[model samples]
Target: MTSLYDADGQALACTVIQAGPCVVTQLRTEEKDGYKAVQLAYGEKKEKNTTKPMLGHFKAAGTTPKRKVVEFKYFAREFELGKTLTIGDVFAEGDFVDVVGKVKGRGFQGVVKRHGFGGVGGQTHGQHNRARHPGSIGACSFPSRVFKGLRMAGRMGGNRVTIQNLRVLKIIPEQNLLVISGSVPGAKESFVIIEK
Candidate 1:
């Protein structure tokens, strides 16, 4: 993340993202695939690391092996197969976009850290080491079982999250970078889909 100044000298917090130099691998139409969408491939990978069927698919698309292939439904423009798309072609500076990505994984977390529970209030009233405990799971008799979708902690994070209405602060067409206002999901170097 970085800070940028506006024309009036006001600073804005932004996150620099490598937007993409994505390739149009295939197009889906309503008559054929029962929908209208475009499939784009991004990043590079060694041919040896790619599977045989994926190699054939790349060969059909007239491109090398790609690390990520994703389909975007309801894309407005028409694009020919194997055409490369850069950040300038898709998004501009000051455009509002939604960034979709996975959040960082936090494996096997407790309720205090996971659900933000203020465990057991304070250390008073003979509370011994039950501060971080999630008090009172379910009822004993009656229905006699813990209900579904309880907020008890298990695995945390690593979920698909979308940050909407993030303003595109700056666009560097030469490096294919987009400086977006506010934070986005996922760790550094993870793949994120930016949609307008």
Candidate 2:
């Protein structure tokens, strides 16, 4: 992520995304696949690590093995096999787009971090070890059981998240990079899907 300045001298926080050079690997039709979608492949991969069937798949597309292949439903127009798509092909400056990616995994987090809990008590004389613990979760006799869907300390993050309506700050066609206002999902170098 970086910062850009406008003519007014205000700094705009932005996220630079390495968009594409994506190859049109496959096509899905309503008659054959019972759906209409275009599958685009991006990022090169080693052939030795790729599976045999996937090797033939990339061979048919006349491209090398790609690490990421995403099927986009409802493309604006039809694209032929082996066609390459760059950042300039779809997006323009000042366009609003949505970015989808996974969030960073926080394995086995506590309630304080996971659910924004403020802890049980203060750091005064009587609050030694129970400050960070989850306060009473249930009644003693009425139901005598913890209710379902209660927010507790557990697995957190590592979920798919979409940042909506992000304004496009700039488009670097030469380098196939997209600059958008504000932060995006996932950790650095993670894959994200940009949609119009």
Candidate number with greatest lDDT: 2
| C-alpha-based local distance difference test score of model 1 | 0.93
Cα lDDT of model 2 by residue, 1-196, tens digit: 9999988999999999999989999999999999999999999899999999999999999999999999999998989998999888889999999999999998998899899889987889788888878898976898888889898999999999999999999999999999999999999999999999
> Which residue pairs show collisions in model 1?
none
22-67 per-residue lDDT for model 1 (tens digits): 9998899999999999999999999999999999998989999999
> Candidate 2 regions off by >4 Å?
none
**TM-score, per-candidate, Cα-based:** 0.96, 0.96
Flag regions of model 1 displaced more than 4 Å.
none
What lDDT score belongs to each candidate, Candidate 1 first?
0.93, 0.94
Query: Backbone collision count in every prediction?
Result: 0, 0
- Single out the weakest 10-residue window by summed lDDT for candidate 1: 138-147
Worst 10 residues of 2 by lDDT: 131-140
